[model samples]
Each structure stands twice: as structure tokens, then as C-alpha cells.
Target: MTPAVPRPASRPRLLVVSPNRSHLALLARRLGAEGYAIVTAADGATALGELRRSPIDLVLAELVMEPMSGPELTRAIREQLAFAEVPVMLIASRAEADPAVRAFEAGAEDVILKPFHFEVLVARIERRRAAAERVASMRADMKAMDARAAMKAIELGELKDRMYQLEAERRRVSA
Candidate 1:
């Protein structure tokens, strides 16, 4: 038998948080087709539980959920280090005054109104993933730089010790 081809990895995992079953199903179906591994949560608390259980690349939440609002969930997520870099977007079920501002201030990256275009939603998700990848790449570079600096510092210390030994030898010979 021919060797099975290895599959490429790295598809973004998305969590969709909404109380409405139909809305959740629709998002899961569309986004899954768009290449995201979809997970559903009934509310903010459930979303957080999912985050704790596994890592999520992005969060799409409904603005108005009972008990905890989307912004509140975003704040909670931001507080956790594992979820801090994950992109969060809020969707409003109804038009409200300054909902976008509220969501942004609370830590959501973007807010979409009701009846948003599917294309726009997919674009936003992709953009968020790209931005996150950039940030993670920068962080990795910084770590590598830091490691190099540490190694150079160690080498300099060793060089100084060798120089001290040479100076002592020279003094002894002169004596």
C-alpha cells in the first residue's frame, strides 16, 4: 500500500457563545465549512469552561446573554494568561446605543451588528488570526534574542576570568 499522505495542521479553533440554539448551529455550520474547528457554548460561563478545558484561537460571542454579558466574558478571558492573546468579537442581536464602544472597552477586538454578512464575519476571523500570529511570532523572536544575549553575557564572564588568570601568571613570572 502507498504511504498515506500527512495532513497539514494549524486550523484555527473557534468558540461560538450564544444562547440561541439556531444561531449557534448556523455559525457552527458556516464557520466549520470555512476551515475552523468549531466549539459551541451556551453562555459566557460555558465559554470560559471551554477555554479552561482547551485552548481556543478565537471567540465569537453574543452581546446579550443572560447572567454574563459578552464584555464581561471578554474581561474574564483577558485576565487569564492562556486566553489573553485570543481574539474576541461580539455580535449584537439588537441595535443598542454605543454597544460597540462598550464591547471594545471591555476587551473585544471587534463588534458586529445583527444580520451581519457571512463574508465579513469570515474576513474578520481571518484578520484576527493573522494579527495573533504576528504577535506570537514577535514574542518568539524576543525570546530568542534574549537567549542570545544571555549566552553572550556568559561568554564575556568566561573571558574576564581567563584574563584575570593571565594577569596573575604574568605577575608571578615578574616576581
Candidate 2:
């Protein structure tokens, strides 16, 4: 067996789904070598099952597969709130525009054509990962901001109540 690639704890976990066994193996090996933890699924159903089983940072699926095409799988994933934010990249066996367009419409983050250079594929994956990280960071910042705003609103309300009480007390004392 080949030695496992040394990966950092923060490395993204990738789910690779393909009906073709060879294709799946190739992607798993190549991507694993690039320091990504890979989980393989032979079809869309298995892929969905894998998603439910564990957290996956990204999904790489073949464009065409039985039971569910890449676009169909993407739609299914998007329908689930937990998996909706996971970026999906589809691999097309041919340079057809229709399938690629469908993949995009279904919410895939990227679509790579077959015969692509390995370097390009890796680069695309890195780009997607980076984009996802940025989005997550922004979401965290928004949540924190919202929390602060809520606290401020509560504090303002308390201050207003105190002022009202003070005004009532002063009027009584004057009278």
C-alpha cells in the first residue's frame, strides 16, 4: 500500500462520487495525494448517505450517473439545510454545454471538463475551498454583529424604562 499523505487537521474533507469506478479511484488517489481527506461513493445515493454520516467540506461528482445526475445530486444536497453550503464541483466527461449549464443551475460551485490538467483541478479545488472559508467568516461576523445589536437594543429599552420611572418619581415629589 502507498503511504498516506500527511494532512493537517484543517485540511478539507472531500467526497468524490462517480458511477465509474476507475474515475473515482483516480480522483481519490490524486486528491488524497494533494493532502485532502477523501471519501468515495459510487453513486448519488451513496454520496448522500456519506454526507449524512459525516461532515464533508466539498463534493466532487461526475456529471452523469445512474439514479441521479450531477445536477440532480446538487439539487438534493441544496435541499438539505446542513449540506446546502458545501461547495460541489462536477466533472464532465465531455465538453458539452448543456450538462454544464444544468450543473450550474442546480448550484454546483464549479464544473471541470474531462482531460483537464491535474494542476488545474487542484487549483480549482483550492479556489472553491478559499471561497467557502471567506463566506463562512463573513457569516460568523454577521452573526456576531447581530448579537451585539440585540444586546444594545435590550440595554436601550432598560434605559428608557429607568428614565420613565425617574420622570414619574420627580413629578410626584414636585406635586
Candidate 3:
């Protein structure tokens, strides 16, 4: 019996943060062409600002940067209640340097090595989003079940009350 709550807009938005200028643009351009609403930032500070300002569905950041690194950004994002479900991926600049372990510790979904295929990035994004959507659907289903259970409890209480009244009436009639 609760009023309908207006849902947030469903647009898929991504924030790409990197101190490197070249590949950042490439990612932005390609991902934008792929129909993502892209937001770009040069560092984690700017990215955090953008996250606060808009509804970002995903984040792609460099593994290392100045003023705020990928791990810092991931930690900050995770600390916020609103961004808890948002997925973050960190891109490493060197093949020999794998930040996967540290990135995971910082709450990043994955660390992408340099020279990664754009297709792989897109696939990861798709999988993350699919999993998130599934979780959201499950939460809604749970809420409905909880409400139904509460209503059933109320009905059972009323039925028991009626039964008790019927027994009392029968006893009085017999007496």
C-alpha cells in the first residue's frame, strides 16, 4: 500500500579517469560510439566530483596517477552508500606491472593491463552490468515477498480471532 517511488533514470553512464591524455580520449570516443554516456576526468578528485554530481554506472581509471590514484578512487567510491554498487576497473600502463591484486583489495572489479582490446573492456562492462541488474531484480522480488508475508500474518491473526469468537458462541448456546 506504499506510494509508487519514482525511479532514477536508467541511462548507462561511464566515467573514464586517466592522467594520460591519449588513450583516455580513445576510450571515451570508442565507448561513446558504443552508446555509453561518457564522462572524462584527468584524476580521481575530478572523478569523485563527477560521481557526486551525476549518476555514474561504471568507472574506468588508471592504476597510477597524481593527486588521487585508482586505488584511492576505488576506496572512496566504495565508502559512499550511493556508489556501493557501481563497478570500477583500473587500467595499468605497463605489461610487466599488474595491479590486479592491489586493485581487488581496494574494491576494484579488475585491473586491465595496457594494450587491452576495446572489445574486452566492453565485454567486462556488459558482464558487470548484467550481474548488477540481476542483483537489483532479486532485491525487488525480496521486498515483494516480505510485504506479502506481513499481509498473510495479519490475515492469520484475524482468522484466529474469528475462530475464538465462534467457539465462545457455541459454548454459550449449549449452556
Candidate 4:
């Protein structure tokens, strides 16, 4: 009998990355109230480590920060295979068009303008969560396909061996 395949991990926790202590704290508080497990990081390096240590569902990052800008952080996250599939949202000031565009180019799922209303932020967060779930579903489907393919390959190898044995028997009998 074949063993059952283990299911994927649970819903991912959210990570808020920004160097600004007040901004990160505020964002965490607001999102945390919305029933999300919020994690905070002060820089791109810390963010990368935090993501590696834990499963992150989504990332909301500021466009401008010390050491690494929002786009830089996004690049860092994308470099890791585990996070390459994760959805990212960039927080940028309204006046920064170039940075916003660059954020999207750098692999942000969405660009959220700064000074946004709490409700607006909440709605955006919900939207991001939905997007992330869809991506996760796609990944799961791909994995299932891979497992099936492996099983098929094994079956084919077994069939080849059986055919070889049958041919050998026919030759001996006919000889």
C-alpha cells in the first residue's frame, strides 16, 4: 500500500519590513488586528533572515529605507527560492513615481501609496492575501503534478522490465 502524501504547510504569516520603527510598529498593529500574525524587520538583511526562519505569506515593505530601499529588499527576497513565490506589496510616497515603477519592476505584486487610510490599508491587505492564496494553490498543483509524473516514470520502468522478460521467454521457447 502506498503511504499518503503529507499536506502543505498552514497559512503563511505576514512580514512587515521597514527601517522606520514607528511605521513598522503601526503597520503591524493595524494588520495584526485584522487577524494576521505580523512579524517586523528593520532592514533588508533582517527581513531575509526572518523570512528564512519562518514561513511568510506576504511582505509589505517601504520604498525608502536605510541600507536597502524597498526595491532592494524585494530583490533580496526574490533571490531566495522559498520567497520567490511569495507576494510582495511596496509602500511608497505619493510623490515617487519612479520608485513605484521600479518597485513593480523589482517584483512587487502591488504598490501602495503612503499616507493611506487605515480602512484602505486593510482592504489592500485583504486583496494581497487573496492573491497570495491563489499563488500558493498553483504551487500545490504543480507539486502534485510532479509527484504523479514520478510515479508514472517508475511504472514505465517496471513495464520495460516485464517486456524484456517476456521477450526472453518467447526466444527460448521458439529456439
Candidate 5:
């Protein structure tokens, strides 16, 4: 049998934020090997700053962190101007489902348990990223249209005022 042809991989820019140094290192290495350019942050504060300064396709945040937790970070990210639709996946070792639910409520697109299967995690991340991109693009277009409409309203108001002034001047001259 002929050897199976290997498919080329699409490298996605992913930000991996975790409070645990060892876990972060392992995740960064694994994801990087799987055709993802990994950016690491030790805490939510640093991750938020990095995300603002750079373009990130996806975010993987650990649920437990000092200073700020994953859900809190996700909320902050959602509040940002350009990143409202950016996909986020929260990671945690806790078996309880409440944290995951909380993360989703706080704006995380999904939650993955630690020691996650590689293929599953990658697939979920890719899907969320694509969906987020589509949503963000639509939102930007809508915002542009809203801005144009506001400008048109301002212009119409000015025109009406000008017409009234001209009518008043004509009446004064005729009288």
C-alpha cells in the first residue's frame, strides 16, 4: 500500500493562560506541536494585557488563578471593544461542573477539563474560533452602518435648520 499522504496543518494563534507553571509549559508545548502558535501568560492580568496588545485567535484560560480567575478574565475580555466575540475555552482540573457552567455564563465559549484529550480540545478550539470570527465580522459591519446612519441624521437636521432660516429671511424681506 502507498504511504498515506500527510495533510498540511493550519497554524492558529492561541493564547494559553494558566496559573500553574508546569501545566502551562506542557500545554504550550503540546499545542505548539499541533500547529498552534502558543502565547503563555502566568495569570489573567498579564493575559488580558497581552491580548490587548496582540491579535489572538483563541484563548485557553485555567479556571483557578491568583489575582484573577478564568471566569473573571473571560468577563473582562468580553467587555473589551474588539474582543467581544473572541472565543475562550476555560481549563480546570476540578471535577465539579459548576465552574464550567460559571465560565460559560461569564462568556467562555466552552470549558475543558485538565488532562484533556488533544484532538478533542483542538477541534473545539478551532470550531469556536471560526464561529467567533464570523460573529465579530458581522458586528463590525453593523457598527459601521449605525455610524453612517447617525451622520446622516445629523446632516438632515442641519439641512432642515438651514431651510427654516432661509424661509424666515425671505418672509422678513417680503414683509
Candidate 6:
């Protein structure tokens, strides 16, 4: 029998939110075909609910929606400590230059204008995902380093206490 091969880890999970159901479904299908695990929401409220339910690696939202727009959703996401670091990308039409600017101000990492190439969109998503992964890795490394530093500080304190005890004993014996 041939040896079993190891499977690669799961791809990133993406949350795609749009007011248009057909467009949302199309985007989900395309992204899914690209090997990303996708979750779609028809509006910001539903998207937030999904976010509260599970972890999402990235959020791609439409610029305009009822009640809550892409920038509004981004702000809400940023306000939540749990998802503050998740990268948010907004999709806007060519006419939405103003709102696109607002998206950046509201903490969107990237905004892709409509009538864009599929390849370009894919490239942008890949770049953002890579950056997010690097940030996460760095954070983990920093946490590990902090733990080591803390442990060393504790060791140093213990050693100093022992040294003080030894000095006191010597004084008592010498006396």
C-alpha cells in the first residue's frame, strides 16, 4: 500500500456582505472556487450576527447598503475588541469616490472599485490575507518573548533573595 499524504491546512474563512443577494452569491461562488471558505450576508446586521457567532479571517463588504454601509460596518467591527484586527475590504462603484474615502477613514484596509478585473480582486484579497497572517505570527512571537522575559525576571528575583539570605547567614556566623 502507498503511504498516505498529509493534507494542507484549511484556507482562510471570508465573510462577504452585500445588499444584493445575487451579487453576494456570485462572489461567494467565485471565492469558494478559489479555495477560500466563504460565508455570505445580505446586510450588515446579518454580517455582524455571523461575526458574533464565529471567527472570520477577513470581511469584504459593499460600500452602500440599507441602514449600515461598508464604512459603518467597518467601524462597528473595529469597535469590537475581538475583531479589531480582522482586515476589512470594501467594494465600491466608480461613482462612490467620496464614500470610498470615508471607508479608509473608517478603518477599511482596502477598497476595490467596481468594474474591476477578477484577477485583480483575487490578488488584493491574497495580499491582505498574507499581511494578516504575518501580523498574527508576529503577535504570537511577541507574546512568547514577553512570557520568557517575565520568567527571567521571576528567576532573577528568586536569585537575589537567595543571595540576600546567604549574606545574612554569613554575617550571623561571622558575628
Per lDDT, the best of the predicted structures is 2
lDDT of all predictions: 0.90, 0.92, 0.86, 0.83, 0.86, 0.90
Reference-based lDDT, residue 23, model 3: 76
Which pairs clash inside model 1? Answer: none
Two-way lDDT contest, 1 vs 3, winner: 1
Total residue pair clashes for candidate 2: 0
Q: Stretches of candidate 6 above 4 Å error?
A: 1-7
Task: Give per-residue lDDT, candidate 4, residue 167.
Answer: 100
- lDDT string for model 4 (92-117, tens) is 89888687789988998888887787
**Please, what is the TM-score per model?**
0.92, 0.93, 0.84, 0.82, 0.72, 0.93
Error (Å) of candidate 3 at residue 163 is: 2.8
lDDT of 3 at 157: 100
Model 1's number of clashes is: 0
Return whichever of 3 and 6 wins on lDDT. Answer: 6
4 against 5, candidate with superior TM-score: 4
Better of 1 and 4 by lDDT: 1
Q: After superposition, how far is residue 145 of candidate 2 from its true place, in Å?
A: 0.7
Predicted candidate 2 versus true structure: per-residue lDDT over 34-150, tens digit per residue: 889899999999999999999999999998899898999999999999999999999996856687789999999999998898888888998998899899999999999999999
- Residue pairs that clash (backbone atoms under 3 angstroms), model 4: none
- Model 5 lDDT tens row, 63-141: 8888999999999999997887678899877775688788988989899986778778877887897797788789799
Best by TM-score: 6
Clashing residue pairs in candidate 6 are none
Q: What is the lDDT of residue 116 in candidate 1?
A: 84
The CA lDDT at 53 in model 5 is 85
The pairs that clash in candidate 2 are none
93 Cα displacement, candidate 4 (Å): 1.0
Error of 1 at 144 (Å): 1.1
List runs of model 2 lying over 4 Å from the truth: 1-7, 95-97
In model 4, where is the ten-residue run with the lowest total lDDT? 1-10
Better TM-score candidate (2, 3): 2
